[model samples]
Target: MLITLIILVLAAIFFMNGKIRSDLVALCALILLLVFQILTPEEALSGFSNPIVIMMIGLFVVGGAIFQTGLAKMISNKMLKLAGKSELRLFILLMAVTSAIGAFVSNTGTVALLLPIAVSLAASFHMNPSRLLMPIAFASSMGGMMTLIGTPPNLVIQNTLTEAGFQPLEFFSFLPVGLICVGVGTLVLIPLSKYFLSKTGTKEKQRGYKNKSLNDLAAEYQLGDHLFRMHVAPHSPLIGKTAAEADIRNRYDLNILEIRRITVPQSRFFKTISQRTAPNTVLLPDDLLYVMGDFDKVQHFAETYRLELLDTHMPEERSAINRNSLDFYDIGIAEIVLMPTSGLINRTIGESGFRDKYHVNILGIRRKREYILNNLKGEKMHSGDVLLVQGSWNAIGHLSQENSDWVVLGQPLNEAAKVTLDYKAPLAGVIMLLMIMAMVFDFIPIAPVTAIMIAAVLMVLTGCFRNVEAAYKTINWESIVLIAAMLPMSMALEKTGVSEYISNSLVSGLGVYGPIVLLAGIYFTTSLLTMFISNTATAVLLAPIALQSAIQIGTSPYPFLFAVTVGASMCFASPFSTPPNALVMPAGQYTFMDYIKVGLPLQILIGIVMILTLPLLFPF
Candidate 1:
């Protein structure tokens, strides 16, 4: 017991320090328990196969499909449109909608999907985005309390009951608690967010480029009149030569933006593929080259090279070319500012090997309020220069992730979100609704976890997500590892007699008053611990103790377990306590004190309500 307590204290210290990842801390604790022979290897490693962990993974994939298909965004936009110039109405609706979605989705996923929408709606209504962002984050957690799969803490409690051979909770067993949580949250947060977050929120930092569309970028760079397409005829001199060997750009004074060719025969769907024009890209007969230059120069180059002009835009064809030529499905454009510390600060565009390294084209350079369009290959890059880059959407997204090279302006993925497969929206909606129905109705006779797994598979099979890798990307592996690593901890505490010791102390200390006082003690302790530890981790550690406490007190364990889950889920006072809270901090320009001011009160009030209400609902 002493050994276990010491390891627990060390884990707690690491968790509070925030220097190490929470998941890594949990894994380290698990390893320590094994090394100390506190647990058998099977006992130590059992958490990886926990059904609760599996369910959480499935839920993440389903939630990601919902977002990827734009079903969530579509619903949010439609509902937000009804607010119609009323800030109060918008606030109420935003909270209600966020909670509703959060009830079924993971709170982190819920907050991420709705964060931008909330910010935009608040701005549209002439209100502070900070006012709505924090509430949305809180509402997502409140919403998670509604269903068995809403959050990991709720699942921890459910798993506890099932493992103890008690009646497991139904899918909607948390509906009432969740409802009250949302209601109380709505009532308390209105005044708190308004007064605390204030009207004049922190202004966003200025960037080199605004959130411009592809057409806007093309126009600003004067690409419309200068861009043209030509076909590589069988007899053309460029048919078998590589781009570098041909030296087309240097000879013809034309830039090859991209090369489009039919990789497969004509019968195959999506057979036509576009590749970025790198130095070694070899030209093939019948290849279509998208180039940018003056129309006369491009025509002269095409004639000289025996190429066929496919779409040479004269003065009258500029608009059509601008609208249709820049197909962003596979190829797209974004602006990236060169970092002062970038290694390519003094290199010419041609010498940087950017096309080979990053698989993109630097179409134009924006330097000192001037746009350089032509002869860009020889242009030397300067620090703080913003380059108009064109490449595959995936390549562009990859560039956004590399902060060491340059900073990508605006949210490129958010812009990609706007171009979601709307055709699959209905399919995704049906799959989601069917999954919900399967879980809600007893006639389906499917286990909740099984149902979630089935839904996740169907989401991938039905093309709700772009691909399997995309679906995998949706799962938060850090949270999964943390929760899975912590599950065995409850068993370790039980094995070491720590849970019994803690429960006995609680019962002896608070039992004289009543079960309600003991329940409040358990609730508040879990709530307080969650302010520093992760809510899921706190719940996993405390649930067995709460159960043992209830069993010892000769009362139903339902209320006590409910208290544990509720207290863990209702964490607010600290920004880093919950993923949703941390997610909105920068976007909302929130400080630690901001959460304390608005969230601390909500946290305390919700705990009081749940402690007073759980025993009545569950019949302790």
Candidate 2:
């Protein structure tokens, strides 16, 4: 018993430190228990095959099917249209929609789908992303409390009850409490969040390049001054010469951005079209040279080379010229940051052959506090250096797939952004609804696990998901392994009399103050522990103890179990407590203190509501 307690305490400390991954910590504790002969190998590994774990795996696939079908994107578009230009309406709508979606899907997955939408909305409204994202994260957690499969902790609570010879909770058993929490919580959070979250004034300097125009992009990176246009003359020395052969940078001290050559098709009567240019592109008479150089140097070079200079008259014309130069349908500009583990680090751009390999133009590089726009061919690439790249969208898509090499920043908000919804959306929706109906009505005469597993399989068989492999990848293995590994700790507690001892101690001390005090104590303790550890792990550890305490106090265990469920799901006080919180932190530009400022108060309010409401419903 003493050894078990010591290991659990050490595990809690490691979990709070955040240096080690939570799954690794849970696995280490499981290994220690096995090494000390505290649990047999079968008992320690039983969590791996638990029905609850299997259901979570199935639910992940189901959620992925919905996401891949672009249902979330479709919903986001409609919500934005409904909210219009009102920030308050947008905020309320986003929170309500995200929460509702989260009740039926993985909260982390739901947040990931909606984050880009939230970021785009913030950019459009000139509001801080943090102001919107924090509430979204909190609402997602509240939404999970609405259904059994909304989160892993709810299932874990039900599993504990079944193990103790009690009837498991029904699928929609948590709906009433969940609705109350989500409704009241949103009412409190909508007004209070503005005070807690940072207000980044009008899009003076948004984090990424999502909503900026071509001219805005150029000015931000200081590329506006160097761009110029020159026309190649009929008798120019550069005519009939390829860009590489001419060596424009060496001969005229200018970098060629593009060459606008008019091509005449054999069948065309009068149409003249522009073609994409490359280093091997041959120059012709009347071809426009978009070059980067000093105005005086460009003028002198034009005179020396017998070329005609194109004067910049209107900014609108210049913007049009710039926009028309790039084939927006096929090409785009993106900002990509080199990750620390990138293999391209320490190599100069010239040596890396990035242009030849990736078929993208490296416009400039931002290293540390400085932007390196000149002499970039020899500039060595470093981890964390941001590169502005222009290329075909296909090439950019390929580059974005290599996450280990670079982190692609905001994709251009314009262009044919990847379609989030497909024709399979209706089919996916139907499958999800059928599964819900089966669980709610017990139509299948089988366990909820069987119904969920069948729905997951149908997701792929019906073509909602791309393939079986894609579905498999959607399951969060770390979460599965962590929950499975932690289950043995609960079993060990019971076998060692640790659960009984703790329950007796709680009942003897807190029971004198009546069941309401005891319920508050259990709820508060679970909520507090959840702030620093995995909520699922907290529920697994405390559920059995709460059940034991209820039995010792001679009352129905329903209220205590329900309290544990609510407390475990209320992990809002800290970002590290849940995956959804961590997922939105960077996009929102939030700090540790930001979560505390908003989440702590919200957690307290929700906890009070749960304490006041659970006993009345369950009659403890």
Candidate 3:
């Protein structure tokens, strides 16, 4: 027990220091417990198969789909209209909507979906996003208190009750408490956020360089004038020939960007197919080749190959091919700056074999302020020259990893996220609704974990996410491992008689004052511990003790358990107390003092409210 206590204290110190990852710290503590024979291997590894852990993983995928399909963003955008131009209205609506979304989605994901929107809205109102962002982060946590699967701490308490042979909580058991939390939070945060946050503006200089949009890069290179499309005519010499066989770049100085083929299915609807212009890619009859070159060279190539030139000078066509054409679903463009130490600094684009080596076509080059568009194959590469390259999004992403050669500007993958699967929004919405119904209704016969698994799989199979790997990327392994590692500590505490010891001390100290005061003691203690460690970890450690304390005092454990969960979640005085709080720190230009000034008051106020309200809701 002494060793276990020492390990726990060391883990708390490491978690609070934040120099190392919290997950790593927890795992170390778990290993210490195992090494000391405090827990057997089976006991140590049981958390991996815990239903709470499985459910949390599933929820991450479900919430990721909701974000990827733009469903959450669309909902929030529509709701913002109700706020009009009133700052007070926007503040209230932001809290309400964020909390509402946070109930269904992970608080981290809820903040991610709403962060940019909040910033944009604040910009529109001529206000700093700092005023709205911190409050939004806090509201996300408040929102998580509303649902059983909304937050990890909620799941911890629920799992504790189930293992204790108590009546399991219903889906909406936390709803009233969640409502009170949001109410109290909203009331307390309004003036606090306005006064503290409005005084600080976003530190744009600290954010580093903001990458330009694809359209901006295209315009600067004047790529539209150099880009042309040619349709393969009958008996064309280019028919059935691969790009390598035709040697188009050498013969005509024209670079083929991609091949677009159209086919009419049995439904008689024409479907357009776009493929990257690989060396061995075969040219089919009637294929439309998108190429870049001087107008004269493009015309010359068309005449030489018996292909018909298609006019793209119309406003709609030009706009479509420029703005809407590269939807980044597959093919995309990005700028890469050549390094001074690059091996190909003095080599021409053709001599460097960029197309053969990287499988991407260099459309244009920017040397200092000069834009070189035509005959790019012969344009010698220079240090600090920015090349506008177009290829498969995957190819562009590969360029980013070549740090020794050049720096791929902006985030290529993040740019792809902007191109959402909006078509799947309704399908994702339906899947979510069905999952919620299954969890909420007693007749469904589906366990909550089963419901979440079904929704996560459906999100992937139904194209709510891009693919399987994309789905996997949504799960936060750190948090999952952290919670899994910390769960065994709770069992350890119970088995070693630490839970009884702590509960006895708590009860002996506060039992005479009535259950209300004892409940407050548990609530405040959990909240205080959470300020230093993860809330989920705090809940796992303290939940068993809270239950034992209630049992020893001869009162219902529900209110005591409720205090544990609520206290664990309502932490806000420190930035690192919760992921949502840390997520908004840099964007909000907030310092440690900012969180202390704004979040401390709200945290105490909500703790007091929950202490007064939990007993009424659950009965002592």
Candidate 4:
């Protein structure tokens, strides 16, 4: 019992520190328990095969399919159009949509999918992004309260009840309280959000000048002063020569940024091939060179080599050049911050061979308050340095996968045009509806887990996702591992009589006040614990205790279980409380105080609503 308590305390400390991954913390606890013979190997490993875990895996695939098919994006677009221009109306619509989608998808995925839309809407309305982002983050959490598969805590509590020899909560059992909270939350947030957010005037002024274009990016990095475009003449000495042979850098003191190649077809037969500049790339007739050099020197060199200087100041001409120079259909632009453990740290960009390794061109580097644009090849990389990179979406996606090395920032709006909406969207929607129906109405006699599994397989079979591998990659493995590792903690607690002890204490202290107060006390305690550690972990630890407490007090466990469910999902007081909150922090430019100011009141309001409503619905 002492060992289990120590492990739980240490795990909570580690989770609060936020330095170690939550899964790693849980795994370490599980390993310690196993090493000490606290649990048999079979008991410790059971979570890996739990039906709840399997169902979560399947649900991840379904969510991924919905994202890949752009159904979520389409819904967001429609919602934004309906929102019109009023900030209050937009806030309500955004919250409603995010909450609805969040109930079915991972909150992190829901936030990622809608972040671009939120930012774009904020821009169109000339409002500060901070005004809209936090609300969306909070709304996603509220949304997860509505369904069984909406959030992991919901499943954890349901499984706990089932294992306790009680009937599990139905699919829509949480709906009434969840809907009431969301409705009440919307009413409270519409007017109160502005007071907690950053003042609109300063933030808007700072962001209003922001533009998304290669040239604009270059300008921001102070590269525009020397950037020039020169066209290769048919008879020029560089016409038939490769970049290495031309010795443009050593001879002319210039670096070629890109090569713009435009092929005019004799008939409608061949397609154009756009390529980036490299040493081995051979120059051809009419090839436009985007080079960096002094204006006068570049002009003199261009005249001496019979090259035509293309005016870049003209917007239309620059746009045309960009269109024909790079295939934006397959390319994207993103900013990635180097993490402390990045391998590239202390290595010069040239030494690291960043372009060659990642298939991405480093456009500029932002370190501290300075932008390193010129002579970036020799600049040594550092942790926290942001790299503005341009590359194919596939390459960017690859970079994003290496989360240990880099943290990809906000949505790359420049690449938004390239995301082709999958045609299988309707089919994916139908499959989702069928899955919901199977769970809600028992239209299919199969277990809920089987229904989810079938939906995931059908998503792949119908090509709702690009491929099986894509669906596999979409699963939140960290979350799965964390849940699996923490499951054993519940077992350890029970074995040590800790759950019974805690439940007895709770009932002895609060039972005289009646089951409603006991329910409120459990909810409040769970909510406070979740503000630090994961809500899923909190649910796993508290659900059994709540059930045990109800039994001790001689009351039905449904209201107590419902309290645990609602409390675990009320993670609004801290930015680190939920994945969606953390994901939106940078984009929203929010502080710890922002969450406390906006979320604390809502948390209290929801708690009150839950205490008042759970008893009415479930009847202790």
Q: What's the count of clashing pairs in each model shown?
A: 0, 1, 0, 0
For each candidate, the alpha-carbon lDDT, in order, equals: 0.79, 0.74, 0.79, 0.73
What's the residue-level lDDT of 49 in candidate 2? 86
- TM-score-best of 1 and 2: 1
- How far off is model 2, as Cα RMSD? 11.6
- Which regions of candidate 3 deviate over 4 angstroms? 58-76, 83-91, 101-177, 191-213, 229-253, 261-273, 283-288, 295-324, 334-352, 377-386, 394-445, 451-475, 508-511, 514-600, 611-620
Across residues 271-353, which tens digit of lDDT does each residue of candidate 2 receive?
23353446778888878777766788788888888987766542222121233223333345678899899899999887776
Worst 10 residues of 3 by lDDT: 315-324
TM-score of each: 0.61, 0.53, 0.71, 0.53
Write model 1 residue lDDT over 433-518, tens digit each, in one string: 77777765658898767878998999889767656888898787776777677767767876888765664565458866889999
Please write out the lDDT profile of model 4 over residues 38-152, one tens digit for every residue.
9999999987897766776776687667767766566656766898667778888889888998777667556755775676677677788888888888888888888888888
- Candidate with the greatest TM-score versus the true structure: 3
Whichever of 2 and 3 has more lDDT, that candidate is 3
Better of 3 and 4 by lDDT: 3
> What are the runs in model 1 whose C-alpha is more than 4 Å off?
54-73, 84-91, 102-141, 144-177, 190-219, 225-325, 333-477, 514-600, 611-620
Cα-based lDDT at residue 48, candidate 4:
88
How many pairs in model 4 have backbone atoms within 3 A of each other, for residues 3 or more apart or on separate chains, i.e. clashes? 0
